[model samples]
Target: MTLAPQPYLNTRVSAMSERLLTSDQIAALCELSLPDLAERFGLEALLDEQLDRRTKSRAVKQALINTLLDELRVLIRPMNATEAGLVLAWGRKYALFNLKTLLRGQLYELDQSEISANLYELPAHVRLPQQELFRAEGVLELLRKLEQGPYSLIARQGREVFEQKREPFALEAALDQRYYGEMVRRLLQVSNQDGNELKQLLGAVLDRVGLLWLLRFRFSYGLSPSETYYQLVPSVRLLHRDRLLRLVNLETFDEILAALPEPLTSRLAGSTSLMEVQRRLGGHVTDEARRTLANGQSGVARALAYLILREHGVLALFSIVQGQLLGLPRELIEIAVEVSEPNCPADSLADAA
Candidate 1:
């Protein structure tokens, strides 16, 4: 796993960490107007993006991701093939977002321009062939084209779920499940020796998303236990398969909260709302990633940790910038940045708005 010399990655990441905005710093920036914030923190790129009325939000979001991924390409240069593949799997989530958009567009028979509006201009290596895929006349055809490309497995799984359940929600869930399933495979490949390496770093993540998704799919969407269970990512220590299966049957938040195992139970005590639970869990994962980044381990774990924190930072930055540019209220601005859940593949900008 010692892919290459560690000094370069360590030094680069450590230096970049200093340059990243602290939570307090970001909070302080929220108090300033767009101009003042841009001048202060050198957010000229965001400022420039805001000037475009038509593509303001989309442009800024794409800018943040592109910058992050470009830096990732540099950081992962020293990694061995397997290590790089793991990082790429994580980074490719954005490109997959485009695939999600395509699927939804085809589902509704939306115009190509409208679909393209929501897609990100991902790094060339990760970018999907949108023009070709856009030619499909229906969701099934779109998926068929998708299967010929990098996301063949994800598309195939999505098709299976769609064919079985015949619902858009389940189709998107299947795609996410397959994506994470593939990610887990690559994660183990890099760190399966002792099963001790990324378990802690990624365990918090898997657990956090798994729990939150279980609550939402089982309750919010009212899917059956078996159906909701299929939508979740692979289980982790605290919320293993058995606990999640039982969790799916609970009738209320109180029952689910009471049934949770130790640590999670104590940590989430008195947390009645799913939002509160999500905020707490998200912060926990963020803290763990920070610790992993600072840990003196091999570059693989630290690099992964860097990407997690870096993604969080850029998103917070985007939330602040997007809110300020749009003249949204302070409360709205603050809430936008708080880590809750990842964007659902089925939701477009319109769906989010």
Candidate 2:
């Protein structure tokens, strides 16, 4: 798809970037205690109104997510169809989550209202037929109904996995695989500098996801090499097909790590836990995105960078809130959120504030 003139797009992107939450804002949010957070945001009474703490917590979280989606809608509204579609594709992760929720709700025969409450209020153009999906009598019925929408292919594959193994993990993995594959395909069709940069960013993300999934399925889930490989998002630069096959066949996590190419191997060195691996890989992506935002020649890259940073801000907030809900120590919560930042050092949170 042809992008509108770059100069105009770049100016718009710059304005949008300026409007994103500043690092200081994120740090301040991270440092707030539960009471402080509720008081500052005027969320305390609304939270207290909920009968259950879990429900209250979900309400708060959904409020934040809705705010983010609103910002996203504003960003996309002025763009041409192709440009908007490209940007909106990043938000499709939420749609995928909603679809998964529908499948699970159907599987368990959950109440329609209950499922609807859990679903994010996506933009109209990007929304699924949630009412119909919620009303589906069972998993098969859900997939059949989904065939009428944009998610038909994924729904079909998910149904196959469900029917074959009848396992939630396998079905979820199938859905993830389909989503990332389609994401890459869509990004590649753009055929411009911005598209190429965005694809590179996504490629790094997909690689991290593929590696993490491989490790989890192989060790944590005890899935066979073949089963684990089947669930991967077809392979990317960091974990190409040959490398993935080799890593999957290995007998130990260390062996798998040893087989990886340089930089990733060095970057992930000495990581003993999956969480550590995730943080390291996430940091790599964040760093790359920052560089792209700073040096990229295309408006798409700058806009995409803002979106990435915005997402990180949301995640850090969620982590802090979850920690507070669990009654974790403030210091630990700070550490968790600080480590999640992209190119920033652990001490950078303090500096930002």
Candidate 3:
């Protein structure tokens, strides 16, 4: 059955697209430190002007999450039963992310108070408890608590890995890939004939994600090719599953770089740094989505508009926080941030970094 068009959702998304920073605003942000920027501007104040919270970095993150949820609430509040169900399906992705983050925070033994501070309140579903999550005794109990969700497999694998005393990054990556894969599947089911563009954009998103995983896995932890490929979420345009499987056989970063597609080859333009590769891939994906949205298709167009705004806010926040945490120079961080688009070529970005 065809659902009615949601003009309100479209309008909110359009408004959000309008408020995103331009090249000039981004350039200006490049110069400010996190605290300095927080004091100088009220992020939500400039947009909704409804939030009364102080304009700190954490506040900005909270405000972004809240604003998105507020839009979702407004869109769904008037939805009929059937439409509301569809909306709920979309909203579950964010809820799943928060749930997994909570569980991982528990596994890592982060302080309960700190974990509570990190909770992203959602528009639906009761939140998992930070205290229970952190004190869950072991991974088994953690997985048991999360049995109600779709990511049970990740928690299960995490349990096995924990016994070996390895960091959970691989497990986390695998979980994300699986979740996003499933989300895409759901999207396709309801996407209608007009959703092909959205599907393509999603495919590109998966490709970028796979690229990041391959590079990070091979470089950061020095995992064997087989081990790295085993954890990869299985959809990418440029590299087949077998190629990544074979990538494990390559001995050096240069060899892996050589094996990447032409579009991703630019990732090798500068330094061979894995972190820089991540930043570049992010920028590349955002830029591609921005371009795709400009082409003006159907639901895809609106999704692209909101997705880009969401990603920009997130990437900007990550740059600010990571820079602040590492005490890196603002100049270096900005350079890294600039390459966050998917096409910028990781090599050049790394060289600049």
Which candidate number has the best TM-score?
1
Instruction: Compose the digit string of candidate 3's lDDT tens values, residues 1-353.
Output: 23434455455556657656655676677766655665554453323345333333456666666666665555455444444443444455566576666766666777767766666765444244445556666656776666555445445555565456555664555456556555455555655533555555555666666767766666665677777887675553556577667766788767877777767777546545665666567667677667665554443335544555565765565566556546787666666566333434444223211
Order the candidates by lDDT, highest first: 1, 2, 3
Candidate whose lDDT is highest = 1
Among residues 3 or more apart in sequence or in different chains, the pairs in candidate 1 whose N, CA or C atoms overlap within 3 Å are none
Question: Whole-model Cα lDDT per candidate?
Answer: 0.75, 0.73, 0.58
**Model 2 poorest 10 in a row by lDDT:** 344-353
| lDDT (10s digit) by residue, model 2, range 72-180 | 7766755666666667777778888899888878777787788877887776756888877766778888888887767787788888888899988778888888887
How does each model score on TM-score? 0.88, 0.86, 0.71
In Å, residue 156's CA in model 2 sits off its true spot by 1.9
Write model 1 residue lDDT over 1-353, tens digit each, in one string: 36333677777778777756667776776787867866765556556743674466666677778878998898788777777887788888888788888888878878878887888887776888788887877888778888886678888998877888878887887887887777777777765422354667777888888888877776666678887887777654567677788887888867888888876788788775677677778787888888888764666667777888888888888788878767888876766675223333322111110
For model 1, what is the alpha-carbon lDDT of residue 251?
Answer: 82
Model 2 quality (TM-score): 0.86
Misplaced by over 4 Å in model 1 are 1-5, 40-54, 192-195, 338-353
Deviation from native of the Cα of residue 321 in model 3, angstroms: 8.2
